[model samples]
Target: MTNTLEALTVPLIQAPMAGGPSNAALAVAVSQAGGLGMLAAGYKTVEAMAAEIDDVRAGTLNFGVNLFVPESDPSDPGRLAAYAAALASMALELGLAAPEPGPFSDDHYAAKVDYLVANPVPLVSFTFGLPSADDVARLRSVGTEIVLNATDPEEISAADALNPDAIVVQGAEAGGHRATHGQAKEPSESSTHELVTLAREYTDKPVIAAGGVTGADIAQNHFDAGASAVQVGTLFLTAEEAGTKEAQKDALLSGQYRDTVVTRAFSGRAARALSNRFTERMAAVQVVGYPQVHYMTAPLRAASADNPEGLNLWAGTGFAACQLRPAAEIVDEFRSL
Candidate 1:
């Protein structure tokens, strides 16, 4: 077996969801249950991320860390300023003060990379973009298996040039951010099945299917479609051990938000989030930056944390199938397929 599949005792890889949903408890539980667990180190500081790695190490020896590759250009400051002002008005309606624009950085890519190299983890995955050949070679020298996320044939071809251990074929249905190499690139509308097949045509490396994967049937479908394993995110959000917010959980289970749409309103980069009043209102806005827009909306998101109606409830098309069970049980369900 390749390192990608051999690294897993079970054929299920817990999708690393950044910005708070992926936690050590969930990662530890999944690994303990015989699946490959992943920690989302996209938004945390180096110290905080190191502490999280220690937490996971304290719980299990088998797991992986996922990083968000920094964007080449910072988000447009002018657009972020305009969006902040617009969000401030909404904040007032909720009895909160406007948020001050904070200095934004890309999760400190170099510091985090150095920390990982010095304190090696079992597996490391990259999303949003690919790392340089030097970075890839350095991590590989330390025996860290690298997996890069790709959404289309072109991206898969580019990732193949780096000779990754495997490719995470994230289809259009995946939740959170799309893994396009550039911010301005439009993602392909290929379904998980189609994308997995396309990726296999490009590389001999293992392809792990992601996007809207919620149950045994979906997992089985991906495996049949040539995926070495299935990466699931939304299915675990409702798990008892998940770090998902209370309001986000309620909104996903409420059955009120019937559809999921790709919107750039929340984070300058397009992501799949539940359609809500806020998303609908900002649909026409000229938001084209990532962490900048993400930071700009921090105040609004924080103030409306209590109200699910006005917040971004991150979920997938399979949100209805999400269960409030233990991570072990969730892994068992995937294994039974």
Candidate 2:
């Protein structure tokens, strides 16, 4: 039998933190602990996503995969060239070759949907944008529950048009990329609770609240605001089961940073990350182009894996609550009373 969100005793959904953190181990641990676990399919090939899905399948049945929806030509080629030129000196300092923008990709969005349609899981959530009606129908045909992420009123209405099983109300406080559907628009700065409340006016579908989920108190507030489940990503950054890099874990627990700022420095998309040298230096030069910007900076980020200042330390506003502990314990902290 396919497991549904209603069947979850703990109404908590682990936010799929792509690029790292969201992994098979983390997903399985949280699912086994009675919360819904998620695997991020962003920046991964279809074969790799399939492997992680297989791993999660081995451990538990209550797991989901998140895909980054493709967008149209989001940035000008001239802007990318200028950005690459700006990154040359920094790359040289890191002993890396200057990055050139690669061809635009849908992040293999079509192939991934095909893979999911053939082998469905209990649920599938989309970030960055919503899938087409045909794509949603194909996935649903295989018993996969569809979930879409929306950042504001316009997005909520757009998501509703697709008739997803649920919608993730991602607010400004969300870490990683804001799910604005396009790079041309500014991200919403509403609080998570505020987003959930506002979303009620648009869609009648179940709401999964995300962004800055601290603990029971915050989760309870979201529940009161009409959220059926709360999705947390930052709080789990230090989880033992997560694939968070050492630099990020240290930066979160080190207490060296004071605040998180949203900038397109890392991915050309608005994402909240800890204050760092890279974000500061690249902020002015950052332009709007997703995988293009993301791929251009991959080498720099990879080389700076040991240096927090040079990496994208994605974290939410409530990052202070992050801890290095078992994911099960974290899930228990958000259980309904």
Q: Could you say which candidate leads in lDDT?
A: 2
lDDT of 2 by residue, 238-278 (tens): 99999999889999999999999998887788889998999
lDDT of predicted model 2:
0.90
| lDDT, residue 16, model 2 | 95
C-alpha lDDT (0 to 100) for residue 198 of candidate 1: 80
Clashes per candidate, residues 3 or more apart or on different chains: 1, 0
Candidate 1 local lDDT, 295-325, one digit each (tens) = 7677778878888767777777788887678
lDDT per prediction?
Answer: 0.84, 0.90
lDDT of 1: 0.84
Q: What TM-scores do the predictions have?
A: 0.95, 0.97
